[model samples]
Target: MKLRKPVIWFGIAMIMVMVVTGVVMFMEKVNVFATGTALSDNGWKAHFSEPLAKEAITNGYVYVTDRDGEKVGAELVLTDKGRTLQVEGLQPGNYTLRMEQKAVNSQFKSLKKKKVDFIVYDSIESISSAADLKLYFERAKDMQSVSVSEDMAGSSEKATMESAKAESSDAVGGGDHSSTNIQVEGVDESDMVKTDGDYVYSVFGGTSVKVIDIRNPKKMKVAAEIKPNDDYYPTQLFLHDDLLIVLGDKMVRYPKRSASQAEIMPMNSLTTIRLYNIEKPEKPVLIREIGVEGYLKSARKTDGMLYLVTNVHPYLWAMEEIEGDALRPRIFDSNEKEKEFMDFKDISILPGAIDPSYSVIAAIDLTSPKTSQLETKGFLGSSDQMYMTKDHLYLTALKYETSTNSRGAEIMIWNPGRADTEIFKFKLDGTNVEFHRSAELGGTILNQFSMDEYKGNFRVVMTEGNMWDERNPSKNHLYILNENMELTGSVKGLAKGERIYSARFMGDKAYMVTFRETDPLFVIDVADPVNPTVLGELKIPGFSNYLHPLDENHLIGFGYETSAQKNPSGGEPLILTKGMKISLFDVTDFHNPEEKFTEIIGGRGTYSPLQYDHKALLQHKKKNLFGFPVSIYEEGEKEFEVDFTGAGALVYEITPDRGIVLKGDLVQKKASGQQYEEWETQVQRLVYSGESLFTLSMDEVKSYSLDSFKEISTLKMK
Candidate 1:
């Protein structure tokens, strides 16, 4: 009997041990690895076997850390009824996801701490098929929804203002005359006016392109007028050899509807290029017409080939109904019978770009215009600015990042009050443009001049943060990248609290101007692509909007002069613009640059188109002359008011020995009591052929002798 009692007690002890083991095993199964951990677009997700404690899914208990154990900036959300943890804003890097004890259900108290080591990819993979493309857009659409509401409130007004600014800003040349003020010596950019030494072609009255014979400036006459159909409006011109190319916008209307349907469909816009045989200037012959679907962004001609870039934003939200090519950009060539949509194989995704727009690039072989040798490719992204050389083309797109607050809620910010620029490079070979690679910079580019390619190295200048916001004052930076678009070296955090106003890259040097209360011209040595350093800085009381190289040792700064004024509201002193300022800088000693001479025009409201458009300035290098059109305004009796004095083209002889000497002024006589500029008489461009200079306005073309500054003759067009 005693032996039986001992055996029964042993069996009971064994049974209790078995029960405990089973319970522990079941608890282990209800952990975070129930499904699996996976990466997502800009984030990652962890699946749990059982629901987690709402309070435990926080920055304290559940967080992401770098390899060095530093907490990473991310947003955590409890999704799928608290069974899933979503962490977002985690860039591509090695990370360790830590889930402390008690992060899961409290019932499983024996749970130990969990740590997951993984890598976050860039998620910038290319689309391989139509399904992949659709999925990519679907995800993009969902992501954009979070911030669309906030963006919509101000988008329309902002877009209108930008459109107006773009329309107002824009500019040609050649003899012993001025060529279009181009960035590259050999590469030519399209402008509103173009000259071939003997004749000047210009877009007049925004309606037609007029060919003016400049062989005899005093007797200059309109040789011919090339007018397109009413559907097209000419904007810019390009002259190569005996071929004249006219670029404009054409309105495409929908098919006519029945009488019962009173509503009309919206019209679409296209960029049209018309090539003319100008062998006989008296009667130009239109040889070919090419139409690309979008608004013209930029165009360049080099190595006997013409390249055109346009941005197209399709109705992607209607992709479900409009299938295939209907959602793609199309191109029409006069050589072909019908227009065709770009093939899917030719459309590739832009790395790091999220915009659902297409940047279409078309290349035309001017060497054989009649043969119709044209190549067009579309990239799924949006381009704000374009810079090109003889061998490569570069495009820039701005990208914004979504951030989280202290509470881990996603908030719409301007990429934390700043934007990043993504640069894409394309190889150019005759009429072929191939995608090479891409890279990113830390700020937004001011304009096309902000980028340059030199000696197989690409140099860029950018401005970060908002200049108007004191809390986040802007800072400038210079980045150098290799041919593959990889960062080779950088000069960062330059000109703190100021923004870049103008930038220019010379052979082995780069000049940048940043402005706030004063202007600082930074001269940087870029001879060593890996270690660029600032050689010198010149601080003055004004800013330069454009920088032109007078020679290897001198630079011309064109901008506005300013004065500090006592603020009526009593904060920071108000900076009041005084007048147009032109500065001649001598960089003979790289380490000691000097503003050799300065010239200031009218005061207060004085303005000139040359401030915004580089092509507006005519550079007669041989004669040491620089000239631009200006509208003069001086401060009046009332505060913040100015009276217009006159409008004219001013020519100055700028030299190191003799500063800036005003050679002549062609001011149009204003009517009695005139207080504003008259558009008809406002000079728009200045060009010189042989010894005669020509001034073009909306109403007439006038010629003046370079020797005496006397008006020779005028040809009225209006």
Candidate 2:
């Protein structure tokens, strides 16, 4: 009897020990640590001592909630080898993170805390000077060993305006000529097409800049060509008076010694800016060549000053041993033996941003007779988009909270896919560019049109969440800020489940397009800057990827045509996209907006570059001419497959009275070698010079009479 009693006591003791050990194992070893104080575009991450199971971090257990106790939708991505939890989709607000007593680790044990608290501040801190930039780089270097978050890796690789003679009657009013679509009245936007009232400058075959003399349409020929050296290829061009600016990249491949033999190593990308005096059209004199270590992100020309932005990814891994001068970007004057790197003092960065990439802004004064000198400023971040006004220049970059090695702090972070935008402003004072102010916003912008400066208030449109996500999907937002880039008023949670496809700001009104299954064109009233409101929305069959303003009351949209089909076993209809779509929207009555006209071209896989690149669109309001390069594709015998048919320029006459009328199709005669190939003779641009219209293809430049649409001449590009 005594032995039985002792056995029971021993079993009871073992049970007690097991219960205590299990309790300890269930307890969370690490507290949730967050990096930034606010929730940013790249949502902040929550770091636990040990990675919890992905299934455990759910809306029911681990999530943020509003003051009303409503759960704020967020995307939780397990990163750092399942050790860190990345949280996205949380907007700026005070919220409680509720982790139930049952919330467990990877082993399915409960967390120690029943609930945790955190506040998503309204804004993020921005850097001030070069010293701040240095510190940011220092921190990014220290975090080299940390794994890059998947959410951060998924953030898109960070992949502008008019001039006055642009508003002339021949340019805008009631003229029979077409011009490059521009943003501002006086600022000239660089394009594949630039007409100086007599000649056209077009990039040919992505190899040379061809000057076409349209003075005599019957004999229009390539007057001159500037073929860059083998190392550099010009992609975009800007013309001011007699000076033509060519912007491109210079890639240098050099031999590097390996363990056994010498190997050719490709150097870092270098942005190449070449200034040429084209006063003598037949011969362009290379006046200056500026080579900076970076890829040209964007550039703008205002008041004879060219503001160029370049994003340079330094050899950060070997930054310590790199030559100090090599760390800076270099500029070489024409005929000068010495190359000058942008001074260290000229580089300044936004504070708190952890981007290792350097954004260099260089301002060149075309008005100055001394073309050798250019003022440069550098920022330590990644630039995705840029917007420039007559007085100010805005460079926007996105930094995800989950990006690897962005900061030096040892504390694990809570950054998910949420991103924060850094807006760096520079004052355009005549010929000099001066750094103005830097600010931060939460969310990712679409493009240059996503940002606008109205009445001293800066307005922007951003998208949150994953576009392909079906569970917690994407949404759009419109934010208004003062000159300092501080958020004043915002209208968020728009088009929930849809991502922004296009945005356009005209004066006090902004038009935005979002898409998933259907396209919702939202008209926002920002006249009150402080209280921006969504006036109305027009749902359409397809989405617009680029929006162009026809007037104060009308907008022209270019995108794709989509149709939805129900599955045999129904859930959500499968959306099938096809063709190229153009829409004319009338917002004359804010309350009753309508798609006045819509035109779908081709079938299945038909595509237009203009849908993805605004530069491909050529418009002339006065001439009622609108055209873009399109490639026709037909559906094949197999489902979801297509075959190329033809490529050309589709010109349309757009007018309020007549609507959209097909002017004519302009196509280039195929090259002699590949004449039968469908890809041959693909027209890329259309330019109007006087009464003649010119269509540019890789193989040739064809001219047509504006009135008759008859081929006037064909100049072989080669």
Candidate 3:
């Protein structure tokens, strides 16, 4: 057929385009996956649906490029059975990652390549203005709507002066004076027991606060029982002059959409505070009550002001768009007619935090009337650990994203890689809370005991390591941050193979215990905040889960006794914890710390509340008395079978010179083989008033003579 030159050329071009498009579509069959949009300065990671051959990945299979499509020189490695890839040496900026899958499954012969764009941040960026925060929230709301699979569900403060006065009387008085074994001397930690010469205020059964008359220790009686709403569970209590404050959490459940349909998670925790007028012990009156949306993270009382912290994870998934007003946390005051939502102006967000969670800090005046106001500051993050000094409140939140392929292909994803902790500091002055500064640090903080402020510098101890990386063994770190939350000095690279079990900072000296197969008690000198030094180390047979300072040079270690077994496959030794272990560490000589005295109790499964919660430890240093709850687990004939050897309080006479001497065991009598009964008694706390020592359980309170450790009286709580 005869045709014009232009028409013939157009027909040829169309045929060429169709052929190229078909080839491109076939080559894109293998999906290259990127876990998240954000990358850390450390590096970026990518994943693939199927494993890749090592040779294929090495020969430029995965690489990152800048905006101009120019290849960036970097090191790429395959992990997780060659299913995951990581790229390092990239700076903080936007970059496009190119991942090429050269080999497909045996069933398919074609392979494809994909590219993804991501941003690597140098550090957490705080919102500069309200407008910026609102925009970030909008983006977060939209991103959250795209449901991530359940297998990928990896979502990761201050001292007050009322404490200053309380510190002066921390020592055990001669006749009947005793106080809570607090982390810091003058800093009063909220506990179940608060004594004022004649009466004892305690939290009982998590359902009510009990006030007992201790004037007659031989015949202790319940003076008053203060109960809150049905949904509230009282956990801790604080007392100030004529008032008693109860701290707890209230869980609210909602009706399901349909009776046949399963209900959502029932418990929505809200931080609740209840103040009672205890002037008349027989008739305690509820003076004030407040419920704020969020689970209580931690709270402290200082200088007559109560600093309360709560972390709220809002139900933003149910809504299409992020509601700015709904984000503000709600608070209820007894004086108010109804619960009121906090003003948006009162809420503040730090830069670099793009998440929608709320970290609310509220300061309440203890002396204020029922109509008193509360000062609150809210940030957009979730605080896991709180460390508060006399003048400042520190909120620490660990930020991390789930990398499913960090480990091999398993249905369940484990939290691997180390987390970056975002620390938000707030200055405290009476009833006012002013945001001071914010900074980011590496590793995860254990608890409040993991942090301390000395000489205007904050000292924090954290364990650093990746669960997936065997080369990066867990190590403890002592980071010294100034008042501005900037790192000034650090004592890193400590206990390479072990993680920090417990840490305590006492003035110029710090004591830390790390464990793997055994315990290594390290004594670090912070006399120079800029050049902190580890003076001595004491290796013991067990790990100390908590460190309590006895005096200037003495420390009490509460933990478990563990034995090491050689791995049959010739890998690292496996540590097998056996029983409750308490060690007395003498650091009188900084060059040589010694575990002078050790106490091992029960058998393979013995458990003690003291090993987990510091509040469970009761000690009267001056009286030379220490005690904690013990649930003896005696061994049986079979490996799995265990015999419960009655639970009770184990008391000891602890002294610098005499060491730990068992005074007696106040055993709670119960029927055999009965795991729990109507009046099941598991001793949890111990306190002393006058010449009597009191042991507290969930169902009853028993008193004993301090001098002879003889049973005196019993008060039952039902």
lDDT of 1 at 163: 6
Per-residue lDDT tens digits for candidate 2, residues 1-718, read 2569889999999999999888876543434444434435445555554556566675366777777888887776777545566666777776666665444554444443444455554443334444555565666555445444433333332212111111111233344445656666566667766777578888755688888887887887788988876778778888888988888778853223343323434477677778889888888888777666688887778778887888887655533333344455555455454655666676654433455677788877788635436667776556778887889888886643322222423422323244556677777887577756666665677677777777888888888656555533566788888876666899988998777888878777788888879999998888997899999999989888877766678887888889999877887788898888888889999877899988888788887777767667776655778877887777788989876666778889886667778887764334455423354367777877677777877777788877778888888766
Task: Write the candidate numbers in order of decreasing lDDT.
Answer: 1, 3, 2
TM per candidate comes to 0.79, 0.79, 0.77
lDDT of each: 0.75, 0.68, 0.69
| Candidate 1 per-residue lDDT over residues 359-421, each given as its tens digit | 899999998988857788888778988888889999998753332233433332234234557
Clashes of 3: 19
Against the true structure, candidate 2 reaches a TM-score of: 0.79
Candidate 3 lDDT, tens digit per residue, 463-541? 7664325644566689998877768899988988567778777788887877777788888888887899999998878
Clashes of 2: 22
Query: Could you tell me which 10 consecutive residues in candidate 3 have the lowest summed lDDT?
Result: 157-166
Error of 2 at 25 (Å): 5.6
Q: Least accurate stretch of 10 residues (summed lDDT) in model 2?
A: 160-169
